[model samples]
Target: MASSNVTSFSHSTFVLIGIPGLEAAHVWIAFPLCSIYIITLLGNATILFIIKTEPSLHAPMYIFLSILAVIDLLLSTSTMPKMLTLLWFDSTVISFNACLVQMFLIHSLSAIESTILLAMAFDRFVAICHPLRHASILTNPLTAKITLMAVIRGALFFVPLPLLIKRLPFCRKNILTHSYCVHQDVMKLACGDTTPNIVYGLMAILMVMGVDSLLIFLSYVLILRAVLKLASRERLKAFNTCVSHLCAVLIFYIPLIGLSVIHRFGNRLAPTAHIIMGNVYLFVPPVLNPIVYGAKTKQIRRRIVRIRTEQKGKITGIYKNKQMIKW
Candidate 1:
């Protein structure tokens, strides 16, 4: 059995189903997927632009949010373009090397996003729990260090995944269930023993998601504890500071948990169900993060509106100049 499993596929390629059970609806699905890609790009871009241009948003919270917007942009770009091409053009065949690259970027950048969220949560905790020392605690150098930590943690934890998966012989199958590549999905196609891949993948998930989530939760718990001690109006005011971050956290982690559950326990179900959950996990956060922050945070919303108003004024001014020229 071991000898039979030793077949090589180093030069082989893989076919991604794009959306296994929804192949018939690829064109229809492209509408929403493309919309998501556009919105994620535009929204995150706006956030980054506003944060850069607006002096009021230079605080630690907004700076962290800008970092998150960058993460979302990268995370969405890593998978959406290929998925969109697969849906519209039926370009499903991917070189194994490209597939590995997609897997690494998607998983690693996503882990970084989660780490950033944890960092943001801690920022909120400090701002709320230790209001006076917010500046001293989350200093510019410290934020830079946190940024480095997030990148290093994500890059280091999953660095081995692609390497491990690359060594596996893909004699069993190369057709992936989802549009993009993932380690677990690819591991299922390997004919060789997959224990190391499975163990490492699970360990990464547990270490990254498990630890990040626990700390984020604890940060919120402490934040809530701090809020409770404040007078009622101040309590609401303090709690409001965290609402945007909380919404972003929920938007990201909930779908992640759903996808992980479906991946682990729903093997017996219809393949389409799994695919929908996987896409949902990928699509929702990037789409919603900007919206949530723009809606919940005043400075971001004001800047967005202020830019729009300025543009409108420019257009109106141009119209008046045209009228004067006509006269």
Candidate 2:
């Protein structure tokens, strides 16, 4: 199954037909994709801005949240622009190196985002389970170390993915099923035996996502046990602190799991459904995170509302002055 020209893989280009079997609908698909991208950018940016400027939000929880915002921004930007270009302008060709870079960024950023979620879950677990030691447990220095480790973990694990793909003989049709390049997605195009790639990729996922997911669940379980011991009112308040994080987690994982299951098992499913599911998990968290946080967290909501109110007041004041002007 070796490709005819192994060296050609280095110079080969791949075509990303936005959604297979739905080429005619690419123009219409642009609307929702663009909207999701716009909202993701605006929402994540606003969250980071507010977190950075609001002194009240300088705690460990908010610090982790800002890290999450950055991850969301990076993850969304890694593929959304190229995707929109493909969908709107019918620009489907991507050079091999460019595709490799995109694949690396998307995978690494995803790994980093997963680690951040685990960190956030840890933060909540500590705060709820051992309230008195929360500050000492999650210090700024420790948080910084966590962030650094997350970054390094993602980089170290995902660096090999691009290299692995680069070594493969991709002499097939060179058409990607989706708009982006992922290890599995790109591996499918290679003409050589892909057993090693598939094995390594699955192992990478198990190491990064599988372990992180297990730990996150363990954290929540401990948190639940702790919450149960609190007074009724305190229990509600404690759970309230977790609502936004919970929403963010669900938005990120539920669709993600669904998509993964469908991909692995639902070969006979409609292509449109497959495409939509793929896009949903990829696009939802970035768009919904800030909205969920702002709407659910009272302090964040108040700060965002105040900013809007101040802007409205300034606009109103300017309009009133225009009525008093002698033009």
Per-candidate TM equals 0.95, 0.94
List the RMSD of every prediction in angstroms.
3.6, 3.4
Candidate 1 vs. true structure, TM-score: 0.95
Candidate 2 lDDT over 1-327, as tens digits, reads 113333344346877767766778888988988888899889989989999999999998899889989988888898899998898888888898999999898888878888888999999999999889999999999999999999999999888998998887766677666788877778888888888888887788789878888998898889898899999999999999888988887787788678778867888987767677877877888888989998999989999999999999999999989988956
lDDT of 1 by residue, 214-264 (tens): 999999889888899999999999999899999999998998998899889
Clashes of each: 0, 0
TM-score of 2: 0.94
Top candidate on lDDT is 1
Question: Against the unseen true structure, what C-alpha lDDT does each candidate score?
Answer: 0.88, 0.84
Judged by whole-model lDDT over C-alpha atoms, candidate 2 comes out at: 0.84
Q: Pick the candidate with the highest TM-score.
A: 1
